[model samples]
Target: MSDAVLLLAHGTPNTLGEMAEYLDKVTGGRAVPAEVVEELQHRYALIGLRETAGAEPPPLTKWTLAQGQLLGRLFFDNGLKTKVYVAMRNWHPYIADVVAQMRQDGVTRFRAICLAPQNSRTSVGLYRKATLAAAEGMEVEFVAGWAEHPLLIEAFAEKLRTVWKVACDELGKRVPVLFTAHSVPTRTVTGDAPDPYPIEAKRTAALVAECMKAAGLGEQDWRFAFQSQGVSGGPWIGPTVEETLGVLREEGHRGVVIQPVGFLCDHVEILYDIDIAFRQIADEMGLKLWRAESLNDSPLLTRALAELALGPYTAGVEVAPISARV
Candidate 1:
């Protein structure tokens, strides 16, 4: 049986024109003129890290490709005869296109893994639905969530430790650790039931904090914060990372280290939201902000994924269920 691994992600537009076009499509033909698209494209252009210069931003798509290639290498290194495929929920190289390509390539059996570690109706759940819709006739198994994977926790802890060491050496003081993840809608948290997100965020933060404490950092020095709240105000996660910074500044925090615990890579959210937006906010608030490097193409993250993929095959162990909290 020819086996393939299908990786799915939420994609981004590759150019301003494409972005504007997508926005118009999503908005049902609300006119987005070419000039508007061009101006917006410049924002991505200024980043200078797009897959193609003067093209629409392919940040998410590029990350998804990198992740798939990394996983493919891991499988190859371990002597697993598997090919990797990447599909996006939005933008070019759409899930449907990738599914068709996979079918044409003679991939008969498959495993689908959504890049998001945590499970929520909006993120992982949506990916699952989309992937299933795309598969239609393909025989495929799915890995729902790996939020509680041991190696994943270890990788995050390792990242925190690395940042803590730098902070100690540079600032001559232990920087307060702020574990952050992307904020989902408040409705997820309060509407008729508790969202699994806050629980998962707290769990991840706790694991990292536990690892830090094991490395001699104290729990009192760390906190869990949420970031990237959309304009909708039903009740996104809190205290917002930016707001936490403000409160910390008021409470006399000198230097702070931020860990984007939610994201696995340095996408626009990490680049713009935390680096550009929050960094500016910290600066204006007279607070020193240092963010840990993202888990982008990190060896530890790769190893974690490898371990997760090979667990059932090599260790004869079933992957643990997603933790209810964290």
Candidate 2:
């Protein structure tokens, strides 16, 4: 059987009009008001103006495609003949469509691994649903639970080390670290059969913190917070990074290293939520906020994905259980 790899992620709209459509799909047809749409557009405008290596901003799809290609190349280098695909959860080339295309391409055996390292039922679980639903009669194995992988921990720690140094140099003192992940509803993870998402995310942060200490970076001045909470929420997780920032300001901290452990690439969350919205708050509070760059097509990130793909993955588990053999 020919092997295929599907790099699954939550997608963003390519245009402002598409944003409303994207919101509709993700929110399960809930009505997103005009004010919310305007706010999202503002965030997108900020993201659009922020230049990357050129005078124009790069699309999230471009980065995600690059990541998928790089991951396929890594697997090939590691002696696996593979065809890689990029499947977005809420945009064009949706997971279902991608799977259909793969079937047409005669790929009967494949692995679908979410781009999110920390597996929450709402996030990774949704990816699993989309993959399995479209994978009709094919041998599909979903990979999960690589949040504590050594390579991933090392990758995050490297970025944290670099950004932490910047924060220290700017503030002239070792400041506190705040790790963040995209927040979902609190109950989705707190009910009877509680999800391992929060615990796994915290574990990744803890591993990075331990690695930082071992490298003589600084003491364990770190706390994990949730960020990029969606609108129309009765209550997402907390203490949010914003709330934490306020607390840090009140606590007399002058600088903070924002390490986003939950995200693998630079998207709306990292671009607008952290770079723009959070930065504005930090400026008002006289706090120095520096976020480590996301693992966007990083060699280390490719290594992590390649390892997860090659690792022993268990199938037939209802929760898309994955074991890290690293």
Candidate 3:
């Protein structure tokens, strides 16, 4: 059977120049001098990815492509004939256009998967609507979230273990673990709106904690934190990871390990917020800070995603395995 997988993402703007402009707008016309932008530029540059200046770049397009290729190889290795396609929202080569391209390419069976591992109405909901709108009359299955996928938990746990070992060696002491994710508006929790953001975030943290515990790390040594509050409002989930670090410093903890459970790749949040911003804060506060590597194109993550795609699909929802993968 000829099938196709549409991996949907929220892309970033293209090019250093374009990014500078976007950030300026996002930051409310603040003068984000070229130097600051250059620092931001270095983050993407480290991964050998660049955005175009004038063009609005799909932030996740490159990531989607990488993931698609991984899935393609996995399918081929498993003796399955499946073509993978990447569709983006809020950027070029949008979901609608990708659907048209897929239709033109003679794609039949279609499976739509949100690149986000967790499910929240704001995040996956928009993608679901876009996918369905693009599908029109086409038959498509959507996989919303896989918060508790055993393989995913295992991959993250392993990543944490590796980083923790390094932190121990570098700091010569047991480091505190701070698990973080982007924070959503407090309204998302208090409003009548159905936002699964908090639930999913806590779930991922809990599972990771369980895996870490099994690896001999005690729960008391780790804490769940939130970050990247791009908005100012009533409240957002916290002890903000940054704030948590400050607390740790006040408590005289000199070594800390950060694990970003909310994101799979190193994007602006990880690059700037954690790597640069938090590092500076930690340094000034007389503490050592390190982050576990993101699950960027990891074979383990890819395998977990493949398994999720093959399972039954849902809309604007999260589904996770009860146990961690070995």
- Which structure among the candidates has the greatest lDDT? 2
Candidate 1, residues 9-40, lDDT tens digits: the string is 77767754467666564334666667666655
Better of 1 and 2 by lDDT: 2
Q: Please list the C-alpha lDDT of all candidates, in the order they appear.
A: 0.73, 0.80, 0.75
RMSD for all candidates, in order, please: 5.0, 4.2, 4.9
TM-score-based ranking, best first?
A: 2, 1, 3
What is the lDDT for 111 in model 1?
Answer: 79
Worst-scoring 10-residue span by lDDT in model 3: 317-326
Model 1 TM-score on a 0 to 1 scale: 0.85
lDDT-wise, the better of 1 and 3 is 3
What is candidate 3's local distance difference test score? 0.75
In angstroms, give how far residue 175 of model 1 lies from its true place. Answer: 1.0
Clashing pairs in 2: none
Per-residue lDDT, model 2, residue 279, is: 91
Candidate ordering by lDDT (highest first): 2, 3, 1
Selected candidate, larger lDDT, 2 vs 3:
2
Residue 262 displacement in candidate 2 (angstroms):
0.5
